[model samples]
Every structure is written in C-alpha cells, then in structure tokens.
Target chain A: MASEAQSSAPDNLPLVLIHRIPPFELSFKSWLPTRFRLLDPLDPSFSSPQTQSLVSSVRLLLCLGPSPLTSDTLDRFPSVQCVVGSSAGLDHVDLATCCRRGITVTNAGDAFSADAADFAVALLIDVLRRVSAGDRFIRAGSWPAKGQYPLGSKLLFSLVNITDNQTWWLFQLGGKRVGIIGLGSIGSMIAKRLEPFGCIIAYNSRRKKPNVSFPHYENVMDLATNSDALILCCALTNETHHMINKDVMTALGKEGVIINVGRGALIDEKELVRFLVKGDIGGAGLDVYEEEPEVPRELFELDNVVLSPHRAVATPEAFVALQEVVIANIEAFFANKPLPSQIELE
Target chain B: MASEAQSSAPDNLPLVLIHRIPPFELSFKSWLPTRFRLLDPLDPSFSSPQTQSLVSSVRLLLCLGPSPLTSDTLDRFPSVQCVVGSSAGLDHVDLATCCRRGITVTNAGDAFSADAADFAVALLIDVLRRVSAGDRFIRAGSWPAKGQYPLGSKLLFSLVNITDNQTWWLFQLGGKRVGIIGLGSIGSMIAKRLEPFGCIIAYNSRRKKPNVSFPHYENVMDLATNSDALILCCALTNETHHMINKDVMTALGKEGVIINVGRGALIDEKELVRFLVKGDIGGAGLDVYEEEPEVPRELFELDNVVLSPHRAVATPEAFVALQEVVIANIEAFFANKPLPSQIELE
Candidate 1:
C-alpha cells in the first residue's frame, strides 16, 4: 500500500523509468530513492492510457540487471534523454538507438572493477594451482584412496616455463609475463593488484595510454606471443568478438594460460576447447563463456581448466557499489551536473 | 655397473647419506649433485661391511623427504655433523638427538616460502570468493538449470564483518583484518603478498618480534578474536600441536575464515570438522590435515570448504628451490662455513 501510494506521487519530482524484469523489481525498488516518481513498465497500470502518457513524459530510464533496452523499448519513451546503466557492460542496451536519439548513457564504471579483477585473479590462481580439481579429488574421497592430489604447477619463483612436453614443470607467477586485452578501469585494477605479485604486465588496447608504463602490444597476436598468460578484460565489441581466434591461440603456444573475465564471445569457444583438449595450450580459467550457462561438456573432465558461472561481478559489495553509482548518476543528471560514469557513444 | 662405480667414488668428495623411501629416491637422485658420493640404504651394498664402513665415515646425511632421521639412525652415522633437510618443515627429524650430537640441521628455508605463501593466498581467495564451488557449479551444468551461481563475498573493498547469522553475506578482502600464526618465512611472505590487497595483518609467534610492526598477539585466542581470518603458517612443535583448538576457533567465531599452509596437526582436525559442520566458523581452505591423505569425509560435502592433499609445497619450483637450499647448506657445512638455513634446536 505504501509503495502504491508513493508510485502515485506529485509532478514536482522528476519522472524516472525503471527497467528490469519481475525477479529484480522488488530489490531495485527497495534501494531506489522514493523522492523520485518511479514508472515501472511491469506494473499493471503501465498498459493504461494515463500511465502510457506518463511514461512518454519520462526523461530518464534506469537500466537494471540484464533487462534488454532495445530500440522498440526506446521508441516508447520519446522524451527519454538519458539511460543510467546499473551494469558495467552495455552489450544488452541498444546503444546505436540511444546514440541516434542523442540519449546519454552512464554505466556502473569502477563499481564492479575491483570485484571483477579479484575474481580474475582468483580464477587465474585456481587454474594454475589446480584449486578446483584438487577440491574435487579430495571431495570424491580420493585423498585416502589416492596418495596425493596430483601436484599443481607452481605459482611463485620457479625457473622452468610451462610447455606441452613438460606439463609437470611449474613456473612462478612473480616473473611471468601477463598480457591484458583491455586497459579500462577493470583492467587497470587487475594490473595494479598483480604488480605486487611480481608479474610482468603488458597490455593491448585501442590506443597506447600515454601515461601508462606497461609494455604495449599493437595487436592481440603480438600480445599472446610475448605473454605467459593473456587476461581478457576488454569490453565486448564488434572488433573484439572472437578476437582470440586460432592464430592468437597458436601465438600463445602450448604452455600459455588464458583468463577471461570480459565476455564469452571474445574467445572462439570451439578453438579454445580444441586447444585445451589437445594440450595446445596449458590451461584456462574462464568466468565467461561463448554461450554461458552452457559451458562445453569437454571442460568438465579436464583437470587443467577452471570454469565458473559468469559471476565475476556478482558480489554483495559490488551490488551495493552498483546501487551507489546508479543513484549518484541519477542525482547528477537531475541536478544538471555531469553524469558520474557517462560512456561516450563514439 | 655405472651406478655402482659412481656410488663407490674415492675419498676426495664429501660422503652424504641419502635417506628416503623408494618412491622419492629417484626424484631426489635426479636433482642431487654428483660432487658428493651418496650412500643409499636401499642399495645392496649398504648392508655390506665395506658400505657400513663408508656409512660410518659420512659427515652429512641428506634427508631426501619425509624419511625419519631417528636417534638410532643418527647413532649409525657417528661422523654426521650436519643433517641436510630437503623439506621446509623438519618435524620428521629427531631434533633432540641432533641437538645432543651438536649436529647442525638445515631446512629448505625461504626456498618453499614463496610458493607456500602463494598457495595460502590462493586458498583464502578460493574460499572467500567460492572460486572452486563456482567452478563445480558450471562444470556440473548447473548454470543453465540453476539460473545463476550464488554471488560470492566481495574481495577488494567492503564493510561488513562476517557473522554466523550472516553466513551468506559476502565481504571484500581489501580491508579485512588477518591474523598470521607463526610469522616466520612463509607467514611473512603471505603478509607481504596480501598487503596489496589492503588486508590489515597482525601475527602471533613465540615472542613479539622486536623489529616487526604488526600487532603481536601473544595468544592464539586473542589473535583469533581480532582477526577476520587466521592463516596458519607456523611449524608443528610440541607447544603448537593442536594449537587451533575449539577455543581459538570459537574466538574466531562464525564469520571468520581459517587458512592452513602449515602442518595438519597445527589445527585440531576433529575440532575443525566439528566447527565446520556446525557452521561455528565461516569456512576453510585446507592444504594439510591431521593424518594427511586422510581428510575428514564431512568436509567433502561442505561448499564452503576447499581441500587440497598437502600440496602447498609440492610444486616443481619448490622442489628446485629445495635442491638449491640443500646443496648450499651441505656445501657450507663442508667448507666449515655457517649453515645457510640452519635451525636452532632450542
């Protein structure tokens, strides 16, 4: 009853459109400020003529979770000038339509960066150290039946380089060369976190960042060739889709590891599976997949691979941070101030 | 015949007794230097009068692995002035006998510290972030069937203290207060490695380290009370055996985590299992157990627990570093030089 009364607020407050599926609506409503008059499409009143007229007058839309903000949806709200994204990636948003309509877009920029970077490192260590496999081995009552969980590759201060011929020979993480695919907030956080571990950081981005000192590789192939591991942290774009193809995998060689926290399609799933199965590459720690929620069945049996449901950014702290960012962006827009995390459409 | 000739080398080189079970003998032989004439007990010549005389003349005994260097074993080697340990922990050695004989004992020292420290951090991240559990969820094809893998606790920055009632709520690793047990080489390395993650570190050791700055808790319970996590990295000694009992674990409380890179006996296995099963503690990342290779079956069912079969020091890099330390200690002992990694048997 309170929410119903609040939903029918006066016109003094700016109208904001809340876009999310049924499951996430209650949670979003719980944190969102009641000062702003909210218009949720899922409401029964949304189909009424009066509510439709009200939605048409909305100036801001809050994109929540994985809800799609397609062109058709954008066409409904003719007066919407800005879309505040609650997630870091904008792949689900119809950015082209937003750009055409001159709609400003703001994302949950650095809010998820630290958590995502932490997950990236967690996955990397899991793959290299065989954390999950060892857990499985011990869980299946293999410790007593088996003498030891098979030794994992080393992670610090070792002389040998991993090779297909020498899978058992471990190398240290301290001096290993790591190539980052993107140099954005998440990527930079990952690099900063890993620097203390003595990793040799290099990266490949759209352009060389003038102030950054990490070695720059002009292309993914070159980055793979010089790196012991390639960490995918770049946003998924037309140019980046399937960028880690067969050639790049080949350049990464037999002993290389790949840690992907970016997106599933950034890597050629078939090629990656083949490389892993054939020992063409050492291992993989993947949080995202080509078709997530459906990881390749072959990976289930491999001790060298570590797989996670696409949850690199799904942490309680991250969710709270996301809420803060979203609210900050909305408040800034309403105050005629610059959006806190606005993304350039170009 | 070639092996026989090599083992029967002239008196010019220092004679070192190789003590290990059959399994590790070959690996030890592969890495040991040829400059020293090695006497193997498993060899047929070892029981012969000539080999017995040769064994009696040995000045250094190289303990290849977990082979027991008992008081009786020490008595056979009347001239053994130094016992070269090939492993980081020297619990297998009869230190009292070595002390009485004025025999210098040298361990792997800092050689295995880096790898062990790395593994400790890996386990901590894996447990707190549910890295291994998330891996299992995806690998089991639960992502599609289960919708989303559960969100893990935060890792970079968050402000929630873990409590029994809030077991499912995750917090970031960045600002958690971590208490280190032992604060020796591996403990110090673990602290150094975690500092970049923004963890506040305190420690408990035999005595308050004068030069160190971390708050020293003289008792384990006090350390546990103040810590969000307790990383066990101390050696197993008479006083430290079962150091982490029910009381200390209770002090750590429901939301605290325990990471063990030390010997299994450092924690009371039975008490640990009870605490974990009852949800009296948050979670654990265990690489060692009381009766290793015989981990508690109850731990296998818990998603919060991560188990590795005593592999914190089993990496190839560790093995190589171990060889270097063993060689250095032996060379130094023979040259009338101070043993590089000598342990005081006080």
Candidate 2:
C-alpha cells in the first residue's frame, strides 16, 4: 500500500542519493525507485551537472552493500542529513565521520535481526554437535568404511573438569554460560532463542544496557573467562578490532567455543587459527573472516572450525525486511517523523 | 545418594533379567550392578544351569539398546512380568507378543527427550539455512572460485507459488507450519523450542493428545499437505513403517523439509533418495537410516540432506539422566509403586 505522499511524480518526489561502489548494487534495486526518485551518481544516465544538482538538493542518502561509505563519499552529498544504511552492521560506513557531521544514520536492524540471529544459533549448534563434521564423514564414505565417527562425549569448558581429559563427548548445551558480545537487536534475540535450550545468558557490550537482566561483564577477558561460548554480534570498530586476542583466548581456556557473525576482524584471525590448530581452543564457528573470500587454507583441514561466507543477513526474508526499513526511513525523513531504526550516536 | 533398600546384599536383591544382544550394551553398564542383581544368560560366568534357574525367578527384565526382543527371548524368561526399555524408540521390541502375554513395558523417554529434541532442532536449522552446505563451499575453496553461493530465495511449500522457482533464498523459520509426527516427550520439547523461533506447530499422532493446543491432522498425508516441514518423532512400528512414502512426499511438495531424529525406516529411504535427487522434495536432516551406518551414495551427491550417524541421544548429560531413569523404574517396580516411565499396554 503506497502512502498518499509517495504517489508524487518523479521530479516532485524526494530524492535519495544512492551511494554505492561498483559491483555492490543495492538489493531490491528495481523496486527502490518506485517509492522515491533515486539519484545514483554511478549511473551513466546521471550527467555530471544533473548528479551535482540532485546531490546538493537531496536531504537523505542511502548507503547500499558493504562497500566503503567514507568521508569523501559523504562530502559529495553535503546536503544529506540522514544516511539510511542497507545493512544491520555499519562496519563499512564511517560511523565516526557521520557522527562528527551530525548526520543521523538508520540501519537495517529491523530487517536483519531475526535471520542473522537464527544463523548465529545454527552455527553454534553445528560446531558443538559436529553437524558439518559428521556430514563430511558421511559424504566421504567414512561412515561405512571408517566404522564410526567419534561418538565419545566431549567435555565442554562451559561445564567441565579441566583435569579430566577422558570425559565423554558431551555435545551438551544445557547449563552453559553463553556470553553475548553485543546486546542489541541481534544479540538479544539470540539470547532469547537460546534461553529455552537452557543456556545461561550474559553479555559484554560497550556499555551495559539498562534494565537488561543478563549479567554484563565490563570487558572481553572477564566475559571469556566465564563463558562456554562467545558470540559476536556488535559492530567492528577501532576499539573492537583484535579485541579477542591470545590473552582473551587463554582466559577462555581449552574448552570454550567462539562464534562470530558480525565481521571478520572482530577476532585476531591469525591468533584464532593458531589456537584452533594447536587444540588450545575447543572450536570456532565463523561467518565473517578478517579478509573477505580468502579464508585461511589452514581452516579448511580442521573439523573444529566452521567457515561461512559473509552471508548472515543474506536470506530473502531479511531482504524483504531491509526494503521495508529503507522505505520507512526515507518516508519518515521526508515526513519529519522519527526514523524506525535510527542508530543512537554516542 | 543410594536408596536404603539398594544397600542390601547382592544375593538378597531382586533379580532383573538383562536381555540384550551383542554390541547392544547398556549406556551406563558399569553403574547398573549397584542397583540390581542382574541375571544375564549371555554372560559366560552365568553357566546354562544358573541362567535357567535365575531367568525363571526374575520378574523384571531390562531391554538395552536397539536389539530385537523376540517371543523366543520372552519364552526363556517365563517369570518376567515387566520389560524396562533403555531407549526411547522401541522398534526392536515385539510389543504385540508382550501385550498378549500381559506383560508391562517402560521406555527411557525421560533420559532421551532433551538431547534428542535439541538435535532435531539443530538439523532443521542446518538444512533450512544450508549451514553444512556453506561450510562445505568454504572448505572446498569454492567460495573464492565461485563468486557467490546461490543465495537465491526458495519459495516454500506452506506459503508458496509452486511454479515460481526464482524466489529468494528465504532461509526463513518464522511462519512455517512444522508438522510433528509424534507428540510425545521429544516432539513436545521440539515444539516448545521452535515456538521461540516463531514456528507454527501442528501434529499427526496416533490420536490427538487430550489438551495439546496445536492443530492435529488424523493422518500423515493430511499433515504433509498442510505443512512446510515434517519431523518424525515416533517409533518405526509396523503401522508406521514407510508412513512417509511417495504420496506424502508429493503432498509435502518441492519446498518441504523433513527431519528425522527418530528411526530412519520411518520414511522409505529408497523413495526419499529418488525425491531428493529429482528435487521433488526440499531437503532432509537425518540422524538415523534404514540401514545402520550405510547411507545411500545418492545422498552424498546432494547438498539438501544432512546426515549424522545414529548418535542423537549420545551425550554425557543424557547418559547421566538415563541412569537416573533406569534406577528409578527398577526401584519403583520392586517397591510396588508405579514404574516411572512405564508404557501403557493397550
């Protein structure tokens, strides 16, 4: 259903500057222009003068894909007061620069939270239960030829006696301390979904969220020490880069598992590999890596690690949701209403 | 925490005929002797004369693992009045013969439900999100070689247009109608866990459970027609063997997923292989098979199915719980109290 105000002619409709790099086109690109007349600078049809004129007049800009949203890009659209991000995580967008410019930013949190959260849980379960490892064993004809894929119980760090190495493969989730790195829309949903499975939920966000009943650790080390699994849900920033290092992994001990869905640089990838290879850490389930597309070849051989392309929010439902959030944010901006998923700048 | 009655001398303790085939040892075998005076004909120490006298005296017997319990085995233990099962699904136990002989039966439902339910949910999420497939792509160096994993939307059967194959990769869990075949302990737990994920739960049990609020279909075919996924949680009895045949798969259609943490013979393995190969069915997550440790070669070629060697209830927590249940049932039977998890003999 089109809002009455959205029915205006192309020239009369509020313009949204489409800021995206090559090969990173916006999802739902075809339908985007139906609501608002889009002004994509990269489009060949937008002559230099026409693009300049539209950029100067447009009050809102849309940042699509994980391409860089640098200060130089923002400089081209000095008139854009609000940046409607097409993703939940704004690691690609220069949040600090946007904050300095007093440019309000709205993310795709409303759209991406559920599916991203679901994927996080999926990865966690896979690693703990050896779901991928078992599938590999079966596909390789090891089930019939190799006799049995290790059915011995694994004593997890979450509920372990470290002195005992003979413990059975527990593959148990109940009564484990699951420390969430961020308590935003995605992390909180993860906590909620895991609660019924008997996980003891806690968190270590930048700032402790108010009124949240989950115990909040002030730092990553403390959280890692107390957690069986560490799930990353916050953004990647200067402060958080390499936040999970050797010392933090040491504190997590030999039985802890780490799951990352936020970004590749959240953990020191090199350190993580060494720990996994040496069996210093129990296991890891990673969706995003320190580098895109190039996963550590070393990881390919380890059954303890699960690697995924950066596609946590790649589901069709998330796309539909992203479109709604983008459309709502733009329309709200023009209507002088509060944006649906605007990020509160520190 | 030994019960006072269990502190008696082994010779004074009541005898429980340990009826098990080779390789089918009790999960907590060593711990069983502390609670009962076990009589096993298969034990070499128990000479044929000792076994004959003990078997005729024992009033209770324990059926461990998935080995068959035939009428011949029952005839040898003429005095046994109750059979205590050490596993949840009793496909191996001959129920009709026991019922005809007016003997009672009990299963390890309490011990197996939580872990079994957790695995079922794990496989469902894995199949739907292509968790294993993504991991495979990354491990195979295909992530770099192949620009993107399909990432297309799969229009599901429950809320679908059957003709349109161009839909996005939904990977959606919310709003999907999940039909559970048996609304027993494990099935109910699965429904509870999925409720937090926003799944619409329904069931197709032998009869509608008295007060379960979820909608119930009288037959598997009707349930398949109306649902997007079918999870088998019941036993593989004669009535239920091959219940999910081609007709049911056709009704579930191209977009439906099936998860079986129950016995694999619950669905016709040959027909399922054909459907998965033809893309006639969406996907499957199986922990058991019609044949032990022998998965079809065709399934290995398809990414749609996730297979786990029959280890659904193999966890330390489950073992600990099973010991508790087994002890409780034996204690209750000897004390003349109702057996804790006794199956109703119809």
DockQ of each: 0.40, 0.40
List all candidate RMSDs to the true structure: 4.5, 4.2
Model 1, B199-273: lDDT tens per residue?
899999999988899999999999999999999999888999999999999999987999999989999999999
What does candidate 2's lDDT look like per residue over B215-236, in tens digits? 9999999999999999999977
Task: Please give the distance, in angstroms, between residue A149's alpha carbon in candidate 1 and its true position after superposition.
Answer: 7.9
Output the lDDT of residue A343, model 1.
96
Model 2: native contacts recovered, as a fraction? 0.46
Report the error of model 1 at residue B79, Å: 2.1
The CAPRI-style docking tier of model 1 reads: acceptable
lDDT (tens digit, per residue) of candidate 1 on A134-241? 798888887677553344322222234423424333446777899999999989888987786678999999999989999999999999999999999988878899
lDDT of 2 by residue, A1-346 (tens): 3685556677777788888656555546465677678888788877777666776778898887666889887887778799998877888888888899999998886687888888899888878777888788788888777453345323211123323432224467888789999899899989989998888999999888998999999999999999999999988888899899999999998889999999889999999999999889988999988877789998898887778877777656666677778888988999999999999876
Model 1 chain A poorest 10 in a row by lDDT: A150-159
TM-score of each: 0.92, 0.91
